[model samples]
Target: MKPELISFKLCPFVQRSVIVLEEKGIDYDITYINLKEPPQWFKTISPLGKVPLLKVGNAVLFESAVIMEYLDEVNPPSLHPTDPLRKAHNRAWVEFASTLFFCQFNMVMAKEQEACDSAEQELRDKLTQVEQQVEGPLFNGEVFSLVDAAYAPLFMRIAFLEKWHPMGLLDQTPKLQRWSEALLKRESVKNSVVEDLEQLYRDHISASNGFGASRFGNA
Candidate 1:
């Protein structure tokens, strides 16, 4: 059965899985929901009340990382490293990428400059760690693994964020910069999000009316 992914367009989690689905050429369906006012059916199926719920026949899976891993496993030619230790390492880094996504969101929604500054520093620090891990031109070199699929959504958001305001988040991490460039250029990553994702981000930032919104709201 073709899996159906419940998602919110603004969700990076959904985008992560979407990239995997796209990369694997999986035939699936995606249902977009407003997370702020989620539907009754969604509330019933989702335990944590999150997006990117993978409904595969009778079984339902939540969590983007889990969904991505499941897709990789079910599909032929796994995206993870063949070595046991290396696969585990990639999984750990994918978890780290999740933290970085939250940090970037916090920075964007920060109502005060102090909060934004702190979030920026924390994000940059985390990105520096990711930089050291990059084997380039992708996360684990030429082959795009699950970890690469995981980080692509974050980089896509950062690209938009950088366009609005040049924070140089990738400046200190030349390797990540190169990695980000590669992921952003990939067909799967580009096709993962909605066509108007950037405009949606702009509207979202303006609506936020926070420190970040004030600076890039007009942009």
Candidate 2:
């Protein structure tokens, strides 16, 4: 039986696991849930009531990182590197990448220009830290690792924001910019989620009238 993934449409964490699954050619079933109104069963299974819960038979796995690790362990072409030290290093960076998601969330929800500016600076700083460590084409040189999966969704959102808003977030970071462009064009990264994701993000910016929407400024 195919494993089941509980997801939210715009959740980057969920996207990470989905990208890994697609990359490994895993057959899986995914169902999007309303985060605000997650079912009772979901609540019972997820201690934190978050998306990206993986159900394998009667076993349930929470947390996107954990789910991805499990999938990689069970599937072929292991997404994580073979060297123990390198794998640990990649894992640490994956955690670092996760922090950027929160930075992005705060940035997206920022209503005022000042708040927005601060959030952007925070995100840029975090990305810069990742940039210094990136040896791309993929996160760990030529081989795509879990680190690549972790950062793909972040790049996805940034790509959309850049096109619609022109934030110049990646202007000074050539390595990350090239890395992101590579991820954006990847087959697994491209097909990991709903086909209308970009449009959905645009609609969200317009509807929320948040910092991302303001950046467009009638353009």
Best TM-score among the predictions, by candidate number: 1
| Residue-level lDDT tens digits of model 2 in 57-169 | 99989989899899999887788889999899999999998889988877776888788788889999988888898987778888888899999999999887777777888
lDDT by residue (tens digit), candidate 1, 101-218? 8898888888999998999999999998888888999989999999999999899889988898898889889999999999999999999999999998788878998897886666
Residue pairs that clash (backbone atoms under 3 angstroms), model 1: none
Worst 10 residues of 2 by lDDT: 210-219
TM-score per candidate, chains pooled:
0.98, 0.94
- Model 2 residue runs over 4 Å out of place are 210-212, 216-219
lDDT of 2 at 67: 92
**Candidate 2, residue 112: lDDT:** 82
Global lDDT of model 2: 0.87
